[model samples]
Target: MPRPPRGAILAVLAAAQFTVMLATSIVNVALPQIRAGVGLSDSATTWVVNAYGLAFGALLLAGGRAADLLGRRRVLLAGLGVFGSASAAAALAASPGVLIAVRAVQGAGAAAVAPAALALALGLHPPGPARSRALAVWGAVSGAGGAAGVVLGGVLTRAWGWPWIFHAVAIGSFAVLTATAACVPAAARTERARFDLIGTAVSALALTALVWGVASARRAGWTDPAVLAAFAAAAVLVVAFLRIERSAAVPLVPPRLFAAREVAVGNLLTALFGSVWIALFFFLPLYQQQVLGEDPLTTGLGQLPLAAANMLGASLAPALVRRVGSRTALLAALLTEATGMLWLSRIGAHGSFFTDVLGPSALVGLGLSVAFVQLTGLSVAAVTGPDAGLAGGLVNTTRQVGGAVGLAVLATVAGTVTSHAAGHQPPLEALTAGYRTAFALGAAILAGTAALAALLVRRTPADGPAHAPAPQPAASGRP
Candidate 1:
């Protein structure tokens, strides 16, 4: 058969990425409708979101490794199948337990789909202007997907019904699956080593516990015994996973990969970036609804400016990277986002969206999207062949885990501030105070990350080689 057009392949990969990210946030607007429709208790309603995140975040490493051992194309097809089917099931679910279970399945499928899709995208274009542009598109889709989800969820839920949200995902998943099968070429798998079952299990458990603990801390207070136990268990399992990787002939996460400074620093910055990225979405809607007295649909519409800015930034990032070095571009992006966060901190209870939200949203959207592109490029710079999938998975894992932890911590901070302020102020003013404090802290975190990146990241020429060398297979392991 003749090869498919490059545009077709790129579209398929971008669609897959957008779909995965959309699933992460699309249901937020429909949560109330879903809860009432399915007779869910308050706790179960929260699980509708948590279950998906836990499964997705926990299985990412394993999924990425699977893509390496299995063919990336093959894994991508399998994940799409699972994701599509699970989406259909979720749409049909009539009970709370069934809905949550299907959501988890959807997340598991997404976990498999995300890394495979990203690795395939990297393989499609070599390191150059072509790859940079491809990554720019990738970054745009990723950053915009969450914001777009809010809009789509509101529209779909209000127009058709809550189930239409799942229906839309199901339809999109199958469409992407068909397109990928037709357009994406299958590559031969080179790694013939044994799969690291122990490492996969241990690492998955540790990530699950850690994400669950932090997520629980948001609702059940940080001091709750169950939350403490979850954190402790996660710590112990992490230590065990590290020890296992050292001794295992074939480790799930090759410790040597971290020897690449780009991978290390890229992931570290991604974590900090992820924290702010997720928190921004979480708090912005609250400010609009609780303080500005906007409805869900209106709040969703309010995010359009941010989404547009994100796309604009993504489009501009490749040019910026070409003009200046990635290090400099990244620093600039981070500072821009920090400035936006600081601006957002000035939001007031009486503020209007135009005066208060629009300018900062534009700044944040621009900065966040550009920073994501740079970080992604850096993270995978030194990876090639078999490790490409692993690098893809590692970067994504850091982002998701960081977002979860960041949101939890920020929520705690906001809650504390709100409680203390409530004693002396009106309800709306107290809530605004909490939101402002969280945004200020978020700005501080971004500034701190930029400072660290400036100190640690090595400068390289535009379109130049990676700072670190590609990882070699461990001497003890056979390939």
Candidate 2:
């Protein structure tokens, strides 16, 4: 197999990523059923999701390093195997604790698969227009998978049962693993580096503690001593983690990646978008429920615009980048998102999704679709093949950490508004107040991203890197 046909290989890798990410969103819509079937308290069901995120985010860097050392295909297959087995176990679990445990393991498998597959993609395709086109397709596929997951999970859970969703994950995992075995090539052997044991522990603990504090803060007042302590401890752990990274043989995050002003600002914009993205999923259901009086199924349907637009934008991203360059494209995209969010935040009690939500979602999806490709392209473009895995890890790590923090912060803010409005207004009024607060804050976040983009994400032709390639990918030129 002379490289397994580059186009087909890209397709297979894309399929593998889609299936893993699809499992994530699909499970969210099925949360209620999962709780009933597995005997989880409402509070505990949130863990079913968080458990996965915690495992996935915490160990992703380690997984990327594993690919660099153990080989990408090996980790991919191992991840698939673990993910499938865990899905099967999750489907069969009778107790909430057992189900939660298996879900975390399943996420660990995902963490391993995701970064390795991305690293493999970068390796297989050189930094050129072809690869950029492939990446546009790949990024779009991922976004589509996530968007489709909600609908699919809802349908499956309604038709078969929540357990069937996990069973479906098992089936999907097996299919991708088999295809990966055939299409994805194994890298030549490399020396295994010492696993960064101390760094791993610190990063995991710090993230878990930080998210835990924020999530719990809604129940415990912000002034609560425990909340303050957790926040303080998180700051300390972060400082310590940085210190460890500064001296470690293999730093968790390479400091030099931020040397490019564009990369640093681009990543910040990404982090803000990441937060807003998750926040939509978190609070939109409330708006649909309280405002429009739609049920869970109908609520999911309302989000279809975002999904459709995201896929649409993804397909267009490569061409957009080809024309405008990564830096300019990112700034344009951020501005679009900010505009959409501001419109969405202003919706009155009488407003409809068709009028209020759809327009912004369209912009958001389009904006994000373009920005992600450019961000990923710039992150690894300067590095050699050997460092590609680490580059992939760094980008994904930024996303996961951002999502974790952003969701928590937004949730806390929404909760605060809801609490303040509870006695000040009627039930629907209070709920709307809180939802609007979140949306308004999101608007601010996106606007800030736009400003950052203008300042940091744009290319300065005058001060371009000496080694920097041209601004965008050409038909045969590198991205």
Q: In TM-score terms, which candidate is top? A: 1
Model 2 weakest lDDT span, ten residues long: 470-479
Best by lDDT: 1
Question: lDDT by residue for model 1 over 398-453, one digit each (tens)?
Answer: 99999999999999999999999999999999999999999999999999999999
**Candidate 2 per-residue C-alpha lDDT over 310-420 given as tens digits, one digit per residue, 9 for 90 to 100:** 778777766676676666666777677667777667765667777767787777777766666766666566555555566666667677767777777777887778789
Measured against the true structure, the TM-scores of the candidates, in listed sequence, are 0.95, 0.90
* Model 1 quality (TM-score): 0.95
The number of clashing residue pairs in each candidate reads 0, 1
What's the distance in Å from true for residue 145, model 1?
0.8
